[model samples]
Target: MSQTRSADRNETGPDRGVLPQRLAGLGAALMVLMPLAMWLANRSAPLTLGLAAALLLAAAAAAGSSREVAARLRRLLATPPGLALAAFLGWALLSILWSHDKAASLRAWGELALPIVFALALAASGRFRPRPTWLRALAFAILLACLLVMVELASGLSQRAALGLGKLMSFVFNRPAITALVLAAPTIHGLWSLPEGRRFDRILAIALALAVAACALRSESASARLGVAVCALCWGLAALWPRLTLTAAGCAFVVAMAMAPVLGIAARDGLPSLILNRFAVMTGQARIDIWLSFGEVARARPLAGAGFGTSATMHRNPVVAEVAPEHRLLLGAGHPHDMPLQAWAETGAVGAGLLVLAGLLLLARLRRLPAREMAPRLALFAAAFAISVVGHGAWQGWWIAVLGAGILWFGPGAARPQGEDHG
Candidate 1:
């Protein structure tokens, strides 16, 4: 009877191992599918929620019933950095509820929730430890999507600008620039992880770079371009001055902001009529006016914001009269084109503080880990996230949640350990 019981245990245990593998596979497939869903839905809430649910289930399943899963989750929650981030997010949500435009605030807050939840879920599952094959699969998906977009854009050229796809192709076919930024980080990390001097590796790197460049160039969206540029600059700074990178980045940001108006105007009215036409009266070009108006609204109701999705009210405010007539049609503006400002305007200072704290906590958590273990990937993710914001404004909740989950699941670095080297 003892032997029979032991035999039974062996069979069942093997089956259990299969479950984790199956779960991991599902998680990976969902990772690819989520972006596709976003493309199809054009970043709508229903699609985002569906993807988020799928990711959570996949992560949970991958974790199985292992004692290690529970232990790791406890450790993660107990970590001061993680808790601080959660607290900040909670504050932000509370602030959102206090907004005058409660419905709008709720809508805006809903967008932020997705990424946070996704990240937490991934971290909790402990199944995101890097796997080369998984990384390769992700890279392939991104490349395929990019290629399809390129083909579509090229095909439309002969049909003239009338049939030209441009942003539509990006939004519907490939990941939007914001999503691209997130996806790009992992692709770069995967590239770096590959054995050096391989022809295929070089080819892959070039292909990814080209795809990224193409997406940026064709986007016609200013913030998206800015996001990619920022990401590149971050990579350079991180390589040169890991310690002073943040300070330098801050300085650079100030300088950029100071110069934006001058350069922006030139871009808006430049001789290259096509480019200028794209920039003129664009959503990004009007961000300054919108941001300024948003500040005033927030000031008027400091404790609670205008409420989520209340940017429309601010847009229709008398302030709209001050903007260029061409830009006056922005009454339906959904956000202030800045994350912190949007938070404050929708939720209040308390909510904004929480969002800020959460971001800082994420950065801090990344800092505590060995650079060699996580820096490359973190750098990529940071670059992508930053770039996306420049072009697309702040990400919605679902994107953030899924991205966070991906990082947590995969953050510890590749399963194969390597010696620490700061450089």
Candidate 2:
């Protein structure tokens, strides 16, 4: 009977190992798939990832880790940073009540809400240690994604044309390029964090970093290029004096959110011809013009904003006539091309304040991490923040999802050790 019981235990042991290892594999695959999805799925990638995350959570529960996961998630949600993010989301939803277009507001709210929810869900579910295999997979994804972008640029988007994806492929690579940039930041530290990393992982890490920088340089996305620049600056500063960078970053974010509309005023004076014409960058002049116009919209309704999701259509608002003709002419560009500016234009002071508070709280929380970990996260945040300030609309679903994906890549708990009893 003792031998019978021993045999039974051995049989069950392999069964237990299978579930956890597979779960870890799934988590890693999701990370890789998320970046690749940026190319094919476009704006819908966020929703795709959110769905995947939900499925992951469901599977985790069914694997007999439900109670432990739930308890951990509860503690996280109850923390100051978690509560702050919830409050910010609540305020954003409330702002939709005042949106000029209710239907659009609701749709936009779903885009923002879904990603935030799933990102938190994943964080509460597992622990992602930087294993050699995971690092290689992460690096390979970056290389593959960047190479595709390079190929498209070289071939004049022949693949997109072949697919009947339309003729206007000028900025087609923007989404994927930016996605690669975000992933690359975390990948940098991830590769570095791999203990006892093999020669392949080391070579892959170097190659991956070079590929990301090259993609950012070669891709048409101005934001991706700027991300590389911003990331380097932030990464260096954070590595040297993490606390200083975090404090400055937190303060800068608050100020930007608090004063989004008028930032252009400080930025737009006597510099159009000097910077816009001479710089020869694609979006330089256009960005300044957009900033000037959207600043008026935000200035028009500072306290309450035009309402959530209004920046995309703020030009149609009667307020355009009130701003200067030069500034007003560019309002049709669909967005401020700036994140903090978008927040101020849509959610007004109330929403912006909550966002600022959440940012500060999050930065404050990072203080608890050792400098090694905190530096990389700070670099990621700073880079993303820079992109938001200069490039993407703050609330765009894909961009937000990409940011969520960045956290999964950089933050703890995106994966777990194998051979665990629970998934």
Candidate 1, which ten residues in sequence have the lowest lDDT sum? 414-423
What is the lDDT for 272 in model 2?
53
lDDT of 2 at 27: 65
lDDT of each: 0.52, 0.73
Provide the lowest-lDDT 10-residue window in model 2: 414-423
lDDT of 2 at 99: 76
**Candidate that would win on TM-score:** 2
Clashes of each: 33, 3
> For residues 1-423, what per-residue lDDT tens digits would candidate 1 score against the true structure?
699557534422233455655665566566655444444344542344345445545545544535554565666655565676567556655654544556665666667665655555554555544355555666666666555445556675333235553344333432354455566666666666566445665577667766766776675455556656666766666666664664454444344333332333433455465543455464434655555555555555556555555664566544344555654454456655555555555556655555445455555445545554445544655564454334334545545643553453244432213443211
Native-to-model Cα distance after best TM-score fit, residue 224 in candidate 2, in Å: 0.8
Error of 2 at 421 (Å): 19
Candidate 1 wrongly placed segments (more than 4 Å): 1-17, 35-37, 44-67, 101-104, 157-175, 195-199, 250-278, 283-285, 312-332, 368-378, 381-385, 388-395, 405-410, 413-423
State the lDDT of candidate 2 residue by residue for 1-423, as single tens digits.
Answer: 699657543422233445655665576577777666677656756765666576556556655666766776786677666787788678778877777777888888887888877777776665333355665677787788888878878888888778876544757778888888888877878777766555655677778778888988887777888888878887789889988887888888777776678877777775656667755454676677788888888888888877788777776766677777777767777888888888888877877777777777777767767777787777788788888888866777888888887877764532221232222
lDDT of 1 at 368: 49
